[model samples]
Target: MVSYYHFQRMNKALPDPGSWDEYFETFLAGNVVWGSWFDHVKGWWKKKDSHPILYLFYEDMRKDPKREIRKIMEFLGKNLKEEILDKIVYNTSFDVMKRNPMTNYINEIKMNHNLSPFLRKGVVGDWKNQFTEAQNKQFNEYHEKNMADTSLDTHFRGLS
Candidate 1:
């Protein structure tokens, strides 16, 4: 949701993960690769739309977590008091998220991949260092056409 290296592998910046339908792509690769966003987002969105479930992306949280959290509370039909909201915000910041046990992926899976602890930098725009120009162009085209909304992408922070 909050796009990152999850779209790209360490070395391959322009990989086509696979196709969901005949039109869009998704990451069916053993390892993630650069710019396969259409596949990933579209796949998840299709699944989410089918289910009576909510899917929140990381970029939305990163941009205004309190707002997003309030949305969550509203969705759950709970009104968290302002004080509790403050506490949640303080505890859910990137610093806290990295260390928090509840959000750690290690507890959720029996992974064979050597993933870092839940705190893989937690900052945005890691792709600038990784993506070649051609790869970025391809990624952007796919993302723009499929996503059509730049609002959700957190990867472009203008570092370049």
Candidate 2:
């Protein structure tokens, strides 16, 4: 949500939340530009079985890129050679993508990269650095409440 807010702010599509607490509060209230994150996920989770949805998680990809890439290949019915798969994994890595002008969005005029890069610290649990103890507790409670009805696994290893 923070990343999305930063992107929107950079594009001049949304106003700042002014403070970290306010930002989190806004998220919990579902007052974001697109809507609540949980609603978005729940909507997709509900429709996944009925639709041809290839639901993927960022943490899963980060944990095992080859496995995730293989899942994508299987979904798309693509059977590339092992060497090609290796190259694909290499090219799509966070470091490679961050450096690649085409993938990085560095040239985007609307985005203020000076404020925050489009691809900023592609790692799990970076939110730990930003969230206060109280905010984390609040967020966890909110997450539990929002996600109670769904079978979606929200756990992200060290994130919690």
Pick by lDDT: which candidate is best?
Answer: 2
- Runs of candidate 2 with Cα error greater than 4 angstroms are 157-160
Show pairs that collide, candidate 2.
none
The worst-scoring run of ten residues by lDDT in candidate 2 lies at 9-18
Per-residue accuracy of model 1 over 1-160 as CA lDDT, tens digit each: 2233333221133443333221122332213443354556566666754776566766778889999999889888999889999999999899887677676444423321243344567665664665556556655665567677434453444334
Instruction: Point to the candidate with the largest TM-score.
Output: 2
The digit string of per-residue lDDT tens for model 2 on 1-160 reads 6677567656644576556677788888999777899999999899987999887888888899999999999999999999999999999999999999899887556677777788888978787787777878887878889999999997633335
Ten residues in sequence with the least summed lDDT for candidate 1? 21-30
What TM-score, over all chains together, does every model reach?
0.58, 0.92
Q: Clashing pairs in model 1?
A: 7-33, 8-33, 8-34, 9-33, 25-39, 26-39
